[model samples]
Structures are given as C-alpha cells and as structure tokens.
Target: MFIQSFLLLLAISFLSAGRVPRPEERIIGGQNIEIEQAPWQVSLQVNGEHICGGSIYSNDIIITAAHCLYEKERRLEAKDFLIRVGSSLWNSKGTLVKVAAIRSHENYNSTNFTKDIAVMRLSEPLNFTDKVKNIPLAERNPAPGTVAMVSGWGATSIYPKHSYPVHLQGVDVPILTVDQFSISAGSNGQTACYRDSGGPLVVAQQLVGVVSSGYKYCDGPTQFISVSDERSWLLNAIASIKL
Candidate 1:
C-alpha cells in the first residue's frame, strides 16, 4: 500500500509539472475576464469608438491588422486613429494616444488577409502602468495542437444579434496547422468575429499571431497572420521609424 501511494504521488507531480493552468479557461466557455490579464492588449479606436483590438509591441509602437484601417468607408488618415493602452475595460479606462503614423506591410493583400499586418506609431510613448505592458513577439511557432488564448472585446454572439462583451473576453483555442485551421473553420465553425481583428493570438503568453480575417459573421475558420512570418518586416518598420 505504501509503494502504491508513492507511485500515485509521483504521477500526480509529473502531471502538475507538465500542465500549467491557462487563466483564460477559468470562465466557462471562455467568458468575460475579471482582471487585466493581458496587459499588452490595446483597443484601436476611431473617433472614440472601438474598431478593433491590438497588441502593445513597445512603449511607442502597437501591432495590429492592416485591414482594420479599411473598415470604414472613408480613406484612413493618421488623425483618425487612436490607441488605448493599459486597460482591460473597453468602456473608458486607459491612456489614449494619438497615432503619429501608420505603416502597413508592403505586401499586404487587400483582397485577402495575406500578410495582413500593420504597425502604428504612437504620438507619444505610453505611460506603462500595472495595467499596461508589452508582450514579447514569439520567436518560433509551437508545434501544431498547442493551445493558445485569444482575448478581445469583440461581440460574443453571431447569430441572434452582435454585441460586444462588457469587459474583455478570452477564449482558449488550439493551434491548428495552417491547413487544418482553414479546414476547421470551413468545416466546423470556430472563428473570431467582428472587432476581434488585429487582436493577438498568444501561445504561452507570447504574441504569435495577429487576428487577420476569417469567415463572415464570425462563424468560420479565422486566419491569423503569423507573426513569425512577418518578423522581418516588423523589425524593419520599427527601425525605420524616427521614434
């Protein structure tokens, strides 16, 4: 009996060491997060309205999807953009920074979400606070089936009526192979929807992908612009900026 109990304890220890709880799963079905869990998250706004989500790449730079700029009918101007950092509450909490400039991936495809990435220079550096921080870009892609978390203030429902969550929402999802991601979205019905664009797809708390595009009405396979694929361009863009 003593030997059997020791072996059971050892097995439990190994399992605990192998599995780290993802706080995003604390809510049932990944519902509204209670704390400012993802400090790097930012809300991209146009005229005081939340348009999409973004990631705080640096004190003065934010990363998001390029397609977000074209969502409006009018041609985008720098003055039209604003970045809200350091807050999880989408209503009215966070430092608002005016956009200094916008740079989109040169190869960004307007038709599809291919190479759909962008960097926005803040007019002034953000005041890093407890609620505001920067997340590191992923150095390498994890093997397929790695679980990742996507957080945003996007509308929760697609069918009945679209509406944004009162607070930021976090959902845990498995990283499907590129092909499988596409097939799953097309076949099954897991996807990111409106207002989720430009949000970060994080693995183990590291930025790995940018919400690019997906099936319409928020029900389909969503495509993420792989950060690993755009690292070169992102580095160049950051270096070229005067700030």
Candidate 2:
C-alpha cells in the first residue's frame, strides 16, 4: 500500500510539473536590489546550481520551504546541498557554505501543501556582516491589507520569453490572508516559475511567509506557508539543534 501510494504521488508530481508550479516560483515586475538590503536572503544550491531561495535565521541556521528539500521525486540529504549568502547574484559573488543538517516539519503534507517549512543547519557558523544578517520570525499573522516584500533569483516570468535573472529581484505585494498574497494586481500579469521557491516574504522586518507553491498559471493568488501558523513546530526545529 505504501509503495502504491508513493508511485501515485510521483505520477501526480510529474503530471503537474509543467502546469502547477510549486509555491511561489517567480517575481514579476520586480526591480534589482543589492544583497545588503535583504541580508537574510540565501540561495540553496546543488552542484553550483541555484535550486531555491532561503533565509538566514541565525549564525548557522537557514529557513526555507519543506518541499525545497526535495529535487523532483527524490529526497535530498543535508550534504547534497550548499548555501550561498550575501550575494546579489545567485551563482556568484557570495559565501557558499556547507549544510550540516536539515529538519523539515513533521506534518508537512505535499498533497495539499500544508505545514511547508524546513530549517538547515550550517556546518560552520556564518560570519555576520553588513551584507549578511538574519531576519526575525513573525509572532502573529499580518492583517489582510499589509504590504510585504519578496526577493529571489527565480525566473522573472513563466512564458518562453522570460529568463532567470542573475541578480536578485524584489517586488512589493499586499497580503491577502494568513497564507495568501496578491500577485494578481501590480505584478503586471507576471507569475512565478522555477528556482524561486522557499524564499522569504517579509513584512515589517519580520519573516511572515515562505514561498511554497503556485498555480498552473496566473489564474489566482499565490500561496505561501504562514510562519506564524507553524510557529510551534518552527521554534522547536530551531531550538532542537545544539549548534
């Protein structure tokens, strides 16, 4: 039964890949920014390739979406990944560090996309600088109208004409609810694509959301995992590691 379920889920994932992009892929109608402005932003890489975005939580901790820990249907280990921080460009111009451990939320549900949070522990502590800083987590949900910002190196558009930018891009968006944000308006008909998942959504200098997944197209608002909603698990995830 477990084997059958796993196969079914894998089939669904392959079928949905082209249509349904997983949790916040791209940043449309965004402007380029220096890494110092959003010092917490970090890149998750495998073999020098930027796979996803993450944020600096502390000297040795990175926070990202739980799903980002997987590549396609295969689950990845901590040693399989490297983290790049303090860079405007995803591929270059940063400090790439080794990951010692990773812990995903125990209740993470890939089917319905719930509790999509994870943390990575670095092998060595990051040397915090003006260009490398940690952002605090949110204690409560933002009001519906609160404007937040997102930054990443994900593809700028979902169409064939679009290409992923080397520099980090950012855009401002309004909150829709506890787990939703509006890209339907000023995004200029732009939607997320690949490589942008697991990025931070900041409001008032605090991380309120983690880009989790998105639609087949820009048919509606994008869904991000609520940090406050999973604060209990997150706090435990962060506190459990002695390093």
Regions of candidate 2 where Cα sits further than 4 Å from its true position: 1-26, 179-192
lDDT of 1 by residue, 108-199 (tens): 76654567788888899877777888888887765667777778877566444455665887777777675411211111233455677788
Worst 10 residues of 2 by lDDT: 1-10
Per-candidate TM equals 0.81, 0.84
- For every candidate, C-alpha RMSD to the true structure in Å: 13.8, 5.6
Which candidate leads the pack in lDDT?
2
Q: In candidate 1, residue 164 scores what lDDT? A: 63
lDDT for residue 135 in candidate 1, whole number 0-100: 86
**Residue ranges of candidate 1 with Cα displaced over 4 Å:** 1-29, 179-190
